[model samples]
Target: MFTRRGFVKLLGGGFFGAMALGGYAFGVEPLARLSVARYVLTPSRWPSGLKLRIVALADIHACEPWMSTRRITSICERANALGGDVTVLLGDYAAGMNLVTRYVHSNEWSKALATLKAPLGVHAIMGNHDWWEDRTAQKNGGGETFGHRALAEAGIEVYSNRAVRLEKDGSGFWLAGLEDQLALLPGRKWKRASMGGLDDLDGTLAQVTDEAPVILLAHEPDIFPKVPPRVALTLSGHTHGGQVRFAGHSPVVPSRFGDRYAYGHIVEYDRNLIVSGGLGCSIAPIRFGVPPEIVVVDIG
Candidate 1:
């Protein structure tokens, strides 16, 4: 029922809309937008008097133009201003993708991250990219990766299948960090069998001698199903909110559960999990709908 002129106009409009969307996704959102995704929660077991403000930064994926040392420093400065009792670095410090003008060296990015300050101190964990990119670690098959050493050298405490007890205002809690769920790369030189991971949830949780509310720092949210109720909260980042979210849905999540744990606060059966959209891109240098975020969690 449409005329030839109307058909041509519709085609032209669609073309321009597509161009605009592409420009925003590739040029603007990824490079310019920064947001603070804040969440305040009180888990059932968390002590009422013990309030903790946790400032968390995830998936640095350090690279030039997209995520430089200067940019990381700026992000840290903003995080410090938030005045958190503790700060946790949810991994992926290595360059997530090959698309980069210049890859930001590990030392450089770690030095920049050293500026971040919190009362309880800064804690970090390894992400899949951190393990996959470390050729020496991959080749060695077992040992401290360059990312771990870099973070340690920077004075940040890097935990892998480790748990530490922290006290705030005479109240204590456990901060447990797990090794990456995708620690081993199968296609690489060292091929034992299938894709195995270094993550040890049982071992990590076993170290929690006391019943203080445990806050688990895991790089990927895929391990959420196995997490027991002993953990009051689990923090993760690795999906990058699919790196192109729309209408609260991510078309392609790196997680086995798809959009279930892609981003934001999720609770199932009284178990709480918060997956940050994170500060860098992965696989591709583009972001839309879900902007880079510095997650602030105030919980008790």
Candidate 2:
């Protein structure tokens, strides 16, 4: 015979344990379904200059139970359908440091990513997970790392603290990307080392002129306030938009600024920031309120 209090305590513990196990199962299983959605962001600066269509995809933590080759290929097909002038992948391509080797060996996965096509081309940057997994030694023998080289081989330009100039008609704009700030943590050797200082935009923007607007692509939205004024627009996707958002409010967004830049479009000062909800799951794999997204920005 147990007291009421003791019975309640035992039931609560059991329920929590079941939830934890369920979460683990969700994370380690492959849910290879695809959904396509688009967003239109009109920047204030160039209101009627270039009609730039940008498709942004981020945080596809492809691992044991999250994503698969079929899913990636499906996403690529949808992106192509959007017919955006440029396709920007905001990082976290792999699940974690330990899963890098497994993904590299999966030829089907690599080929699926390689099949992603865009007229202007696809550009990407490294995320924390990418650095963590790629920079670690595999339990299985063989020296292989994940970073720009892998994406490059697949025809996706990896921009780590670098910028590329895109020209349309007679006008051109700058596209800049930074290495994951999380890589700077102690005891980790990032595959693509980031240039120190969050305020260090001059080095990345050296090639760009004041004539055209600058679009900055950083993996995490935490660097929003740090980005230079020269950048007219910034795109990020690390928070997963609280992945499991409530009906009217988002859960605790793990960032220094709380829910200030949790998800969706936000205007800060003169810079326009768009934080995508991302396409896949991680940590606790189940996404309740926040579904995956593919943001489409039509710059006119």
Candidate 3:
């Protein structure tokens, strides 16, 4: 009953739809949710009083289809399974200003995130995306007002640029966070109080006793060089390991330093920097070579 041209068009449309669905089912959908853990052991001259196993999850740009309640629950379940003493969320918990409103307006997301538990409790910092994107008011002026409140209610402390101390086994470490360097962009002036000065390593160290190991958490890996030598280890997750790496190369990274600040462990002088690939996508929703990561750092 159909014309030859119409029949061909129908067949072509069906074929394309099948291919699209197949691709998602076999490729993108599977990658939409994944968990990877990288382990590191830190040996220090100080007494090995605490075998602190901290799990770091960062950049969960939570949005529909890609980042959802199921995905978050999966991440939490996996982290709990790892049995980490402390869980640290590096930043960029929401996708962006617009998407966050679409998702985080209700309390469901926050309540789900609250389920994540750690013996030492969970600590967090704000990523550039959170400050620049999520906080931007749209035409409606309805921005992250509720989302920020939700995160706070969920018991996740959002450190703009501050430090908190954690004590265990008679020893303690300093955990400091800084405002996003991207705040350096035009129109968004980062408060001096929120942009902790890394130029004075000795000054920052003065705040904490040398006996306790210090761990600094910054959202971007570009801040690595600025960190003080006194910081035993620094955890970050902005680069996303070049979300779409290819053939031993990460072609796309958000850093100005390019591959120099790509991913993995980098040690310079006495400072150690661990750049996590992160657990979510940004800019582009597809990930090729880069895989989501959950980092575990064992400091003894």
Q: lDDT of each model, Cα atoms only?
A: 0.94, 0.72, 0.69
Higher-ranked by TM-score: 2 or 3: 2
Quality of model 2 by C-alpha lDDT: 0.72
Residue 156 C-alpha lDDT in model 3: 78
lDDT of 1 by residue, 222-293 (tens): 999999999999999999999988889999999889999999999999999999999999889989889999
Ranking by TM-score: 1, 2, 3
After best superposition, candidate 3 residue 286: deviation in angstroms? 0.9
Question: Candidate 3's residue-wise lDDT over 73-96, tens digit each?
Answer: 788888777878888888787674
Alpha-carbon error at 60 in model 3, in Å? 0.4
Output the number of the lDDT-best candidate. Answer: 1
Compared with the true structure, what per-residue lDDT tens digits does model 2 show for residues 1-300? 799999999999999998975664344322534445555666667736688889889887775435666677777788778888889999887774243324533345556777777778888877766655653522221133365567777777878678888888778888998777564434224333432222245677786756688899888888888777778789998888876677736767856787888888888886789898888776666665567778888877
Q: What clash pairs does model 3 have? A: none
Name the candidate, 1 or 3, with the larger lDDT value.
Answer: 1
Best by TM-score: 1
Q: Ten-residue segment with the worst summed lDDT in candidate 2?
A: 135-144
> Per-prediction TM-score, please?
0.98, 0.79, 0.78
The positional error of residue 209 in candidate 1, measured at the CA in angstroms, is 1.4
